[model samples]
Structure formats: structure tokens, C-alpha cells
Target: MIKNIIILFIAFLSVTDLFSQEKPFWNDIQKFKESDRFNPPVQKAIVFIGSSSFAMWHDVQDYFPGYTIINRSFGGSTLPDVTGYLNDIVFPYHPKQVVIYCGDNDLANSDTITANEVLQRFKLLFQKIRKQLPSISIVYVSIKPSPSRKHLMTKAAQANIMIQKYLKTQKNTSFVDVYHKMLNKNGSIRSDIFLQDELHMNAKGYAIWKQAILPYLKK
Candidate 1:
């Protein structure tokens, strides 16, 4: 009976693994598709794609009045998540410009993921975007220094540096440094910019981001 039970347990594990492979984190993408069905967004819009930071930006349109904007950010997602849903969230819109705020979640989501690994993921997204869009301008927003995720700041800083340096090498790519601006004079994270969760940014934080990002937008 014990041997039979072990075989059954192994079978259960196999079934679970198969289920996981068949179904990815796709519910959010489905909702976006549904929303688009009823209220289709304009094509060639500026798309802000990333994790919770962009997801929580409720007043993002207010920040930039003259520009056409679309926020396709999904909170609790890493770089792979964004790339995974490229067909649904990214390419469908035919974005004129793509602004990204990821990598922080990549490090915070998994302890084993190295900064260089995060850099590689970003590079993949970069290459894919350039290949697919060709003439589309891209912007990489540096990861913010948050009080809650201070422990992962080292990796975050490294990922930012790597991505920033790489953007310098590519044309029509810009790196907005919200990281340095989010730091206090003593080099600590400025807590006032974040909400009580100490992870997502508040309105004041978005204000600072607006100042940093506006100049880089295509005039």
C-alpha cells in the first residue's frame, strides 16, 4: 500500500507540472484584451509597460497632457512577464514609444536571480522591441529606491547601471534616472515619495518622475 501511495503522489506531481506549463499568468492579459474590445485605445500611442509602479500610476495621463498615452503595466510582474505577454499588451497597440520600469521586481521576486540575469532579460526585451518596431523610440526608467525593498537596492542599482549604459549605445533609446533622484542627500531612499506600503510611489514621487521624464519625450 505504501508503494502504491508513493506512485500516486508522483503521478500527482507530474499532473501539477503539466498544468503549470499549460497555463501561465495570463488572466491579466485577458482582461486587457476584454477592455480593448469595448474601448479600443488609439494605435501608435506611448505605452508605459512594467510592474506595480506603472500599474499604480492612476494619474499618469494627467502627468503628460499633450501626449497620447497607454498604461499596460501589470503589478507583481517581472521582466519575463512583460515579454511573455508581448503579443497581447505590446505589439497589438503598435506603440510609437515604449517606456519601461522593471528589473526591481525581477530581483525582489527571486533571491537566486542575479543582477546580470536581470540585465540579460532587459536586453532581450530591448532587442525584441527594436527588431519588431524598428523605428519606435524606447525609454528605460531607472528603478526607484524604495524603503520597503531597500535590501534589494544593490542589485537594483547594478541592473539600472547596466541598462543605462546599454541604452547609451543604442539609438532612439533614453534612460531616465529616477533612482538617483529618489535618494536622499545622505544617499538613503526618500521615504516621502512612496506610499505606506513603502514600495509603490505616491503622487509626490510621480511628480519627481514627471520632471525627470518629460524632457526626454519626443517634441
Candidate 2:
């Protein structure tokens, strides 16, 4: 009976591992890398990696023209997607800094993952990046609080707290708190900052982001 139980445990572990494999976001990564939106080869680059926020920020170069900035953003990508391809998409560029924005898609997609879990994945991704490129700096952009996703506001705030705390201990990691800046007097997202759907940002939103990020990029 003990031997039979051991065999069954092994079978169960295999099944669990199979179910744990993440859904593919590689197709979008592949397409983005091939598209005109991706930055060309550069020396001492600064990479921006994330979801639609990063993708939609079209004026990154205009904001930080002094450094070679590569925008490797794909719309609707979650943390797991960016974590999977960090080596190929980010490390090869030998960037001085990487600005990351993710997690909104994870919450929006009904993943039901806890705030700590999202923080853990961010830690894992940072570890992977460090293993390949030890000297590179990591700048984590706070997952902005959206009025449209007000139902998940608690989740977003909790995740930001975890991320902020995590950033404090790391050597070259920093948190960019765009959430507080985006809020209006009533604590809703500033409607003037976002586009039509109130999900993504407009030029004014990008301008605020540019001002917040310029100091770090100059460093």
C-alpha cells in the first residue's frame, strides 16, 4: 500500500506540473520584435518593458533623447509573459536601466492571483535578469489605479504596497509611483489623463510619466 501511494503521488505531481504551464504570450512578443515599434540596435540602452502602457507611450525617445531607449512593450501582456522572455527581449541590449510596467493585465484577466504572488513573480523576473546581466538597474513602474477597474482597486493597492516594499531592499531597483500622481481630488483616475476607454493613457498622461521618469534616466 505504501508503494502504491508513492506511485500515485508521483502521478499527481506530474499532472500538477502540466497544469501549471502558463498560456503563451510569445506570439505577441515575436510580432512586436518584428514590428517597426521595436527599437533598433543601440549601445548602453535604456529598455522599457511592459504592457499597453509602455506600448502606447510613443514619445519615450522625445522625453529621454539623451539615452538610447528601447521600448519593448506588447499590448495586453501580463507579468508571466514578460517574465518568460526577459532574456531574449531585454538582456541582449545591455541596457543601463529597465523600466517595467505589468500586472494590470493579470488582474484584468481573472487570474485571481494574490498581491504577494504578483510580487513574487516580479522578484523571479528580477532574479532572471540579474543572472544574465548583473550590473543592470531595474525600475518598476507602479501598477496605476484605474477608475474603470475600481472593483479591483483594493487588489491594485495591495500589489503596489508589496512591490514598493520589495524595491526598498534591492540594490539597484526602484519604484516609480505613477498611481498617486494619476489620481484626482476625488481619488478617481484623472479623466484628462486617459484616452477614450479610460483604460489607457493619452499624451497628457505620458507627459506626467515623462516628468516623473526624467530624473532617474538622467542619473
Candidate 3:
């Protein structure tokens, strides 16, 4: 009986540990929830949702001073991850507009992941958002040409084009073309805009983004 009790206790411990394990970006989401509880964000603000590009833009609010911006981007997140947490980051805010800057990670995630697959994933998220908030304006920032991900550039461009074409068909949607703006006259990616790691951007890159995205903001 003593041995059986010990085994049962060990099994219980194992299950508890399993349940306690947090997935990627789970902590980030929890932090956002905690912040919201302490000091809630104003509803109907522009909610920027996506991966590290938007995540690293910590001063996004300053870029567009007049606009009420609530950025909920978590580092290294993909379209699927954002879609998964839409309830927590998006709908809860009742955002007047959602500006998405993702899909770069999706292409870089795996060679097997095609441009079409990325488009499909994006479409899934868009559909879910439209179903929930029909009148809300949606904006997609084109995947920028990162010096580190040069190999994936062509694929990323393809994905961006596909997304832009799709967004054109949808009502209240805008596609910001930062990809072309970030390129040089020679068509090579301007390396000066990237940080030391080359994956993320510097202030110069964000400035270019501001110019392209400013026109599309709802107010």
C-alpha cells in the first residue's frame, strides 16, 4: 500500500507539471492581461497586433501622437499565434482598427511552409476578425526585406503580394507597402535600417513605416 501511494503521488506530480508548462509567448499574454487589469486601455483605439516588428516598435504610440494606439505585439509570434489569442489582444479592446505586421516569421519558420500557406493562415485570421467585428478597419503591413533573411526575400514578397491582392477585395482593409519603400534604387535591401542582429529594424525603418502607414489610419 505504501509503494502504491508513492507511485500515485509521483503520477500526480507529473500531471501537475505538465499542466503548469506554459507555451511560447504565454507569459507575454499574461503580462498584457495583468496590465489591463491594473490600467485598462481605452476601447476603440488602434490595436497593432503581430510579431516582433510591431513588438520592437515600443514607441509606436509616439509615431502617431494623435491616434490612440494599443500595441499588443509579442516577439517572434506568427499569424497563427496572433489568431489564437485574438480574444485576449484584439476583441477585448474593441479596437476601431487593427494593424497587422506579421507573416515574416511564417516564411522564415520553415522551408516547407509555402507562400500560399502563409496567405491561407492570414486569410483565416482576417475571416475570424471580420466575422467578429464586421465594421472594424483592418490594415496589413507588408513584410520588410530583412538583411538576415535575404534567402527568404522572394518568398516574402510573393506572400505580401498575395495578401495585398486579397485585402483589395475586402472592405475596410488597407495594405501598406513598406517593402518597396525599404528597398534602394538598385533593388537591394537597405541594410542601414536594420539593427546589429539584422532581423529587427532600427528607428530609420520605423520612420519609413510611419510615412507609408500614416495615410491609412482611421483618424
Candidate 4:
């Protein structure tokens, strides 16, 4: 009986490990929850949700003074990841506005994924948000022209255009176009704005974002 029980326990451990591994960024979400439990977030603040771009912006609050900001971004995340974690990252905050910076990783993640798919995923997220918080403002930061992901620029542009068009018909929705602004006069991506990795941004890139996004924030 002891040997049988030990075997069952080992099997249970294996299953638990597998389940945790299956959930991408689970630890990140858990950490957010833990932080919220102790510190508590400011209700009705502007919440930023998405991938590494927003996550890397550790100083996002400093960029906009007098605006309450709650950033729940997890690095290396895709659109679906954000959608999957909406309960944790978004709704609970009862936010006044939501600023998103995603869909970049969705395209870069797989060749099989298309721009239209990115738009669809975004719509799903939008629909869910509207269903739960009907009156809240929504802002989408257009996927940046990352120097490292230059090959995927066409796909990114297509996704951006479609998302921008879709948001036009929705009330209280603003699409901030940072993609074109990040490009040079010759229409090339500005390499100076990116970090050494060419994937993430440095201060200059965030500065551009601050300008583009500031006007849309709720006072």
C-alpha cells in the first residue's frame, strides 16, 4: 500500500508540473495578484495591458503626470495571453481607460498567423471589455516598427490599419498611430529609438509613445 501511494503521488506531481508549464506567463499573473493583495491598485485608473513593450516601460507612470496608471503588462505575451488573463489584468481594476500595446508578438510568434487574425483577436478582447465595462475608454497603440522585426512590417501595418478602421466605429475608442511616427523621412524604421537588441525600445521610442498616447488619456 505504501509503494502504491508513493507511485500515485509521483504521478500527481508530474501532472501538476505539466499543467503549470502549459499556462504561459502564469507566474507573472500570480505576481500581479500577490502585489495587488498587499498594495492594492488605484481604482478607475488607466490600465495598460499587453506584451513586453508596455512591460519594459517601467517608468510609464512618470511619462504622464496627474494620471493614475496601473500597468499589468507581462513581457513576451501575445494577444490571446492578454485575453486569457483579462480577469486578472483588466476588469478587476474597474479602470477608467485601457491602453493596449499588443499584436506585435502575435505576428512575430508564428508565420501561420495573419494580420486579419490579429485584428480578430483584438476584436474579441474589445468585445469582452465592452460587455463587462461598457462605458470605459479604449486606446490601442499601433504595433511599432521594431528594427529587429522589420521583415514583419507589412503584416504589422495591415493589422494596424484594420484595427484603426475597426476602432473608428466604436464610441470612446482611439487608435494611436505610433508606427508611422517611428519611421524615418525615407520611410525606414528609426534604429536609434531601439535598445541594443533592436526588439525593445529605449527612452527615445518611449518619448514618441508618450506624445502619441498622452492626448488620448482621460483626465
Candidate 5:
């Protein structure tokens, strides 16, 4: 009986470890929360939230001069991750507007994640924000194309289409077509837009984003 009890305890710990690994980004969210406790963001500002794409936009304020924008992105985050920590990042700021760039990470995180699944997840997120921040102006930047993740581009493109269609039916929601814009004239991912990793965007890519996204932001 003693040996059986010990084995069960070890098994429980293993399961707990696996659970923790599944949500590794939780700690990153907590850190951001703790930071806010000290130097909180300006209320009613524009929040750029999502995965590494927004997290690494180190010069975002420079890109959008004279805008009250706060960057709360944690790298490798997914749509679910953003929704999971919305209380910390989104709700806390009392944002007047929001721009999101996610979904690619969800598709890249697993092979089984479908375009429809991503679309549904995004719809869920949209509904949640609407229920809470009814007057908020929200923009969804389409999943970008990448040289390294080109194999998944088709699904990402499909997800973008679904999201676009859905957003059209909603009020005060805009879909920035960054996906199509990121492609070259030949309909291929622009090699110059990405960094050395061939995954994340470079300054040129962000420039494209700035042009596409700026017009839609609340003035």
C-alpha cells in the first residue's frame, strides 16, 4: 500500500508538470500584471496586444506618434492566451481602442488546429470584448505571411478570410488586410519584410503594417 501511494503521488506530479507546461505563458502574463501594479497604463489608450509580433514592436510609439498606445504583448501568445489573460491586459487598461495580431501562433502551435477553429476562437474573443467594452473600437490585423511558415499560410489565409467576413457583420470592428499586403506582387511572402528568423517581421514589414493599420485607428 505504501509503494502504491508513492507511485500515485509521482504520477500526480507528472500530470501537474504537463499542465503547467501547457500554459507556460501564464507567468509572462503575471509579470505584466505585476508591472502594471507599479506604473499602470494610461486609461482610454490604444492597446496593441497579441503574440511576439506586438511584443517585439519596440518602436511602436515612434511608429504612431501622437497616439496613446500601450504594448502588452507577450511572445508566442495565441488568441486563447490573450482571452485567458484579458482581465490583466485588456480590461485593466480601460482601452478606448484595441489592435490585435494573433492566430498564426495558434495554427503554428499545432497541426490539428483548423482555420475554422481559429475563426471561432476569434469570434469568441470579439463577443467577449463587445459584452464588456461596448464602445471600444477594435481592429484585427490579419495573420501575416512568413517564409518559414509558408506551409501554413494557406490555413492562415483561410482564417483571415473568415475573420474578415465575421468582422464585417459587427459594428465598430475593423479587419486590416495585412496578410494580403505582406505578400509580394507575385503573391509570395515578401522576403524583405521578415528578420533573420524568417518568421517575425522586420522594420520594412512593420512599415507596411503602419500604413495599413494607421487609417483604422480611432482618432
Candidate 6:
């Protein structure tokens, strides 16, 4: 009986460890908070919140020069990680609009999350933001179709469609479809618009993003 109980306890611990590993973002939040660039003094700012795409885009302020813009991105992060630190990075500033581009990392890292799960997390995040700052507009940038992550395009499209549909029913939420703009005639990512790695955007890519967002910025 003693040996059987010991084996069952070890099995329980193994299951717990597996579950913990599945939530990869849980371990990265502290590092994200420490390295976050958008510190404060961000009253009425247009904050860009997301993973490496936002972090690596070096010309965001120049692209949207009129508004008080803040880039609160950390590379190698996902929506779960952003959700963990939303209050500190997002709500304290009371932003006028939040432009988000997350979930690529979640798709890349996690094996079990379905398109539905990704959409559910987005809905949860929107609710959290609404509760904290009721009047703020939440703008979700559609996950760009990357040549490197082409296999995950179907999942990405499904997630984007769900989010766009949900945003239609909300008061201050909008979906920015950069995915459609980034595609070439063959429905693949435009190689000319991306870096050599085919994962990140080049200067031309940022220009396209800027043009899409120009109309929305307040004078």
C-alpha cells in the first residue's frame, strides 16, 4: 500500500509539471515587466501593446507622429504574458487607444491551443481592458501572415475572423486588418515587404502599417 501511494504521488507531480510547462508565458512575466519600455506619463497616449513585432518596429513614433504614442512591447511574448501585466503597463497610463499585435508567440510555442482558445483569451483581455478604462478604444491588429509561420495561417485567420466579428458588437473596439494588406497576389506574404528572415517587417512594411493607421489618429 505504501509503495502504491508513493507511485501515485509521483504521477500527480508529473501531471502538474506538464501543466506548468504548457503555460510558458507564466515564467516570462517578471522579465517582461522589468524590460517594458513604456514606463509612464502616458496620458491619452496611443499605446502599442504586443510581442516582438511591436518591439522591433523602431519607427512607430515617426510613423504616427501626431499622437502621444507609447510602445509597451517585449519580444518573445504572448497574449497570456501581456494579460498578466496589463494593469501595470496599460491601465495606469489611461490610454486613448491601444493597438495590439500578440498571439504569434502563443501559436509558435504552445502545441495544444486551438483557434477557439486564442479567440477566448482575446475576449477575456478586451473585457479586462474595458473594466479598467471604460472609454478607451481597443484596436486589435490582425496577426500578420509570415512566410516562416505559414503553416499556422489557417489558425491565425480563424482567430482573426472571430475577433473581427466580436469587435463589431462592441462599442469602442476595432479590428485592423494588416494581414490583408501584407499578402501578395498569390495570397502569401509579400517578400519585398519583409526582412531577409521573412519573419519581421522591413521599412517598407512599416510604411504600409503607418498608412493604414494614419486615418485613425486624432489631430
The C-alpha TM-scores of every prediction are 0.88, 0.83, 0.91, 0.92, 0.88, 0.81
Best by lDDT: 4
Off by more than 4 A, model 5: 1-22
For candidate 5, list the clashing residue pairs, or say none.
none
Model 1: residues with Cα > 4 Å off, grouped in runs: 1-24
> What are the lDDT scores of the predictions, listed in order?
0.88, 0.81, 0.94, 0.95, 0.90, 0.81
Return the candidate ranking by lDDT, descending. 4, 3, 5, 1, 2, 6
lDDT winner between 2 and 5, please give it: 5
Please identify model 2 stretches exceeding 4 Å from their true place. 1-23, 32-40
lDDT of 4 by residue, 1-219 (tens): 999999999999899778768999988998899999999998999999999999999999999999999999999999899999999999999999999999999999899999999999999999999999999999999999988999999999999999999999999999999999999999999999999999999999999999999999999
CA displacement after TM-score superposition, residue 144 of candidate 1 (Å): 1.2
Model 5 sits at a Cα RMSD from the real structure of: 5.4
Steric collisions counted per model = 0, 0, 0, 0, 0, 0
Best by TM-score: 4
Clash list (residue pairs), candidate 2: none
The regions of model 4 sitting more than 4 angstroms off are 1-18
Candidate 5 CA-lDDT value? 0.90
- Clash count for candidate 6 is 0
Q: Please, what are the lDDT tens digits per residue for candidate 5 over residues 1-219?
A: 999999999999898778767876866776787888898778999999999989999899899988988898989988988888788788988999989999989999999999999999998888888888998999999998899999999999999999999999999999999888988788998898899999998899899999999999886
Model 6, which residues run further than 4 Å from truth? Answer: 1-40
Cα TM-score of candidate 3: 0.91
Residue-level lDDT of model 3, residues 1-219, one tens digit each, is 999999999999888567547566777888899999999999999999999999999999999999999999999999999999999899999999999999999988898999899999999999999999999999999988999999998999999999999999999999999999999999999999999999898999999999999999999
Indicate the TM-score of model 4: 0.92
